[model samples]
Target chain A: MNAPSANTLGANAISAYSISAAVPLETAAQLEETLRHIGATRYHSLHPFHKLLHGGKLNKGQVQAWALNRYYYQSTIPIKDAVVISRFRDRATRVEWRHRIEDHDGDTGAEGGIERWLKLTEGLGLDSAYVESTEGILPATRFAVEAYVHFVRDRTPLEAIASSLTELFAPNLHEERISGMLKHYNFVNPDIMSYFSRRLTQAPRDAGFALDYVKQHASTPAERRAVCNALIFKTNVLWVQLDALYHAYVDGHVPPGAFVPAK
Target chain B: MNAPSANTLGANAISAYSISAAVPLETAAQLEETLRHIGATRYHSLHPFHKLLHGGKLNKGQVQAWALNRYYYQSTIPIKDAVVISRFRDRATRVEWRHRIEDHDGDTGAEGGIERWLKLTEGLGLDSAYVESTEGILPATRFAVEAYVHFVRDRTPLEAIASSLTELFAPNLHEERISGMLKHYNFVNPDIMSYFSRRLTQAPRDAGFALDYVKQHASTPAERRAVCNALIFKTNVLWVQLDALYHAYVDGHVPPGAFVPAK
Candidate 1:
């Protein structure tokens, strides 16, 4: 077998390193620190598009593309949560998780995160039916969101939970997004931005439980590595969507048949 | 329900039209014509990346990105086929479909299509391990591929079979790819291009059976439209992968962590 190259050392390197060397276990605090470090360096908040978005550099059309594409990701969350819930055999564990479904889907007559997201799309002048159809969203948006669902369905339960740890960084990004969009764009308002406002609270609560679960359950060093890698994977899942958005909308090379902002 | 708009007519307009009107049934020959129309218009061979790659306009590195990104799609064929197989209750249908799995993943010692694809990547100088890890492929590649597997797993069996109808156009593209790449690039060799050579025969035999299956089984107009739409969906799956390639490689905006063509 070939030696693990020096470049193959972090998240993507797990498979290579797992075969050759023992990953040293971290304490709970250390694991938390490591996860935080991943958030610091790898999170989508640091992505260039987010910088452009929050800095008021993008025009309204660009912002519309972001909202339209992101709706695809926002809408898939409950489905991902449900897949995670299905994987758990214990009723109590599922009961604890069922709140996530409620949080996204909402009770009868109550507005949910998805409906709130649609309002944001509508605020940007996207037709509600078009946004709901997801017909015009970028291919990368569909792929990234769908990957999240499949990951939860297919990964070990621990890794699935660990992937959710990206939520640990979510509240801060939501804060940035809400304040930035409201301040910069004429179209933004409190009602449409409610999704971010709601997520600011919901994400932290969800992330806390997930972080605690992952830290406690991923006891072995290899399992810990997998947990870290899963976060990194989740980060990529978020990051790549933005990358596609930046390439298509920002760089102006939108693929044929994808959403094109009306000039 | 709203009436179907004059604009909402073909494969893409199904969801709109389905709610509004009774789709007129077509004779077998007419149904075949519609499927062929979808192939002619929507197939990925029409993608710019294919034109560049086949025309020898792309450098070796750009070619490498295409091959590596495409490896994800090629490798998943067996898994998608297996999902389709699992959906079938009849032993005869499953038996007929099992050849797809076998074609992708050959018997012991006889290299399958996937392995042959790796030889193409390796010929372009990518490490076999990195290629297999799929760590470096485009996110769109993964999403498009996983969507395909999920579609086969979750959609009705007839729709699942119809999605495979993109193969109806595959043999001709494979022929073009082989001759064009051979004529242009010194890096292209018979051994590396063997995957296409093999598929020239295999895809036709497979597409023939699938066409017959879909043509015979989709007895109603709605079902036939669904079959046509499924082909269109599959074509989009293929087309979008190339679109991602073009956006990233040709347009010179390789997403932050995707495969970078070596200078």
Candidate 2:
């Protein structure tokens, strides 16, 4: 993690990013555009490694690396979803979000996304206990995952729901991952990619629900701004994970005492 | 701002910093020590620019920068304090915390910390309206400052109070800054330094009351841990500001558009 060579983005980059132009987005569609712009520009979906993974270019170990690292995110989803669930006072909203927990945790063994995620890790030759320990996960990954949990736990219920709108884009990301990895990575099995398959359906419904919730509930201009800002914060949360991964593994200055793959 | 690259703590340096032997400490004292540790390591007191400003090494422009950036933090104090105030159901606790708001916002002209802060800003030749607009502060500074405000708003009351325990450590930092800045920076007049003088007596008293409350109230190990974690998080909240500053000014990649000094 050597001093990342001064500012990673440089001063000009900061100014360019901060020099925000105020375009009045007129519709929820326009609002959606704002959210999407953040994702297109800021989401981990745009990260180069993701491009490599989805384009069918990754090797077995690299795919293993992705699965192993992503496991922390998978495990934390229910916990984070539960935080959102706890915030819900409306019986209907709670009932809907509660299904999300069930979807990830599954009613019984081998049923939910968590179980399917295990299949991916198992396919990658990761020990379930080690994976569950989450000790070996990149600290950056841990930070990003936990940050999402904190977001739900700490934000106003609406803002929490708004932050989860990242899921709206997740379905698209998953489809590309499945197709790209299937076509490219020989070590990956379509069977093992079952987790993304569930996400393909689950993320969209959840994202739609969240997006509609934000659109409808963010009734005031100020509320709309908060919702927009919430999504922006969330995009950063995901992007920071890549920043960590790139810095740690790709950039070769991995923080000391973090997971080091066997040579 | 352009995408911030992976911030490396230098793997080897981070590694060397990680492996300390566990010398068991009193759970209570250990908690206190952990809180103090966060203050020592992450608190804004450690920022080198703080060193330059307080040690009188900075020019008028730098002092202006310090006042400008710091006012963002000071302005939010009452708002954050108010949220914490709202949480206190006990009339006495609420009454006590009420003083914090009064101290920061001022009851009348020539009184209160908020008024004093403005005086300092004016003394530095900043327009009151410009400082109020907060148009010139760094984005990182605003986020970090808001994070503190949000912490008090979102956390449980005991933990919110526990987070304020940084005040116990602050009086000393204030003393250092005041003495050093007074000695080093000619732009810093005694009246501008008056804010620290007031904080010297006030912060310690406020902190003493808070420390007693935390020690007496956070009796269980789990509660103790939460209190300790709040302090740690609070420290990081402050520390990240310094990291942002160093990355910008010191590293020379000053994220494109932070406070640029007058030529």
Candidate 3:
């Protein structure tokens, strides 16, 4: 059923299975299973660009585009988390969410996820100023990241928390990325890979809380469907960034005024 | 200087000229010149995809892709305009801005921009329900349009008004598209191209007010720069939609689950 038949409606087909009928509300384990099924099929790890990236098939310029464009996404995580926090009325829930902002932005003078992301870009020869300014990334990158912030700001709190569940699938991808890049690319090393390493722990803790919150809060069939749709939306955000990178860098059709890796 | 040089940073170079030096503010005419210069160089009309589209170089499927993806952008205009209206405190200003929402959404039974846009899509043999659902659009299209909404929601009212000044460059593109698409493609006709025909009038009226608003309100040098940058941001929003279309359809690398034309 996942194979997109001629009669199926493309990307909409993935959701069609759940949306076609009003099934009975699932138990906690069943809901988790449904969420996991979404991750298994639709995560960005399944994207071709990730294949090229982790397999070391991408050249240095392509890799630079990946890091440079991805910096925008990494930097915006704290902003989106903050927006998510603002939506919560409960102090305990807000306190639980505040850790996400801390993880990305850090306490005074501490290196946060954003700075670690810069280390990866700097390792690949992009200027910290330029990366921090986010002036060189693909337009798709900006749009995708900004959309995530808006989604959290505008969607219901239940949906916002569910969106963060993409992190449940993230750790495995990070592990593969770290080992694959370290094994394959001469330029990639432990320091430059620190962002992924840190995420291996942070993502699981974050995803665990988010998953629990969603499982507990999504009390009805419709609420459960919205939760699933939010995860799908977040995955689209990640997948589109890679699609833009692959289009511009690997395919070598850089839009006028976008970043072009030096020969 | 417009050509991306080997030493120059890619798309970021366009903004470099502005960031490098802070110049004195100008007369109304000079400010208009600067705004038009940004449009001349960065408008989506300048994208190669537009050249392909207006030149009738793209096939029917390609045109369908263009229409389908752009429906997401067109449909969201009222929502973004509503967000813009929410930001204004002045009663007179809100009244003036309210026309934008009406132009898109229309009065009872009056065919507005969104409905007219559907005529274009339906004329191309796409189901109205499928088009309205927007379930098959490129992820980039969603991200780009959503970013524009967020920009309006998040930025100051002055900047939001300036962003709408992109309409200044719209009428001519509409004229070109109407004539070119009509002359070149048999599927295109005055009935189907009513959206463009309508916009030719609507754009100028809207752009005139927005342009005057931006020029009058952006009093300081920094404020003027922000206005110019806002227009540039809006231009990027439009350009990126075309870029996504080109990358996905023209480049033959549609992301998994996006619309794929039947053979």
Best by lDDT: 3
i-RMSD of model 1 (Å, 1 decimal): 4.9
Error of 3 at A222 (Å): 1.0
TM-score of chain B of 3: 0.92
> What TM-score is obtained for chain B in each of the predicted models?
0.91, 0.84, 0.92
TM-score of model 3's chain A: 0.92
lDDT of each: 0.81, 0.69, 0.83
Candidate 3: stretches off by over 4 Å: A1-25, A108-110, B1-13, B16-24
Q: What share of the true interface contacts does candidate 3 keep?
A: 0.36
> Comparing only chain A of model 1 with the true chain A, what is the TM-score?
0.91
Q: Report the interface RMSD that candidate 3 achieves against the true structure, in angstroms.
A: 3.3
lDDT by residue (A1-263, candidate 3, tens digit) is: 55322124333436421332332335666567667867877899998899999999988888998999898888888889889989989999999899888898878989899888989999998889988887678888888888888888888999999989999999999999999999999988999999999999999998999999999998887888778788888888888888788878887767656777899
In angstroms and one decimal each, the interface RMSD of every candidate reads 4.9, 6.3, 3.3
TM-score of each: 0.88, 0.65, 0.90
lDDT per residue (tens digit) for residues A1-263 in model 2: 53221133232221212313343334566566566655555556876668767876555655666677788888888898899989988999999888888888888544988889989988877788877766555544655566677778877999889888888778878889888888886667899899988788778888889888888887765676667767766765665455445444554444334566666
Those runs of model 1 whose alpha carbons end farther than 4 Å from true positions after fitting are: A1-23, B1-25, B252-258
RMSD per model, one decimal: 4.4, 9.6, 4.0
Candidates arranged by lDDT, highest first: 3, 1, 2
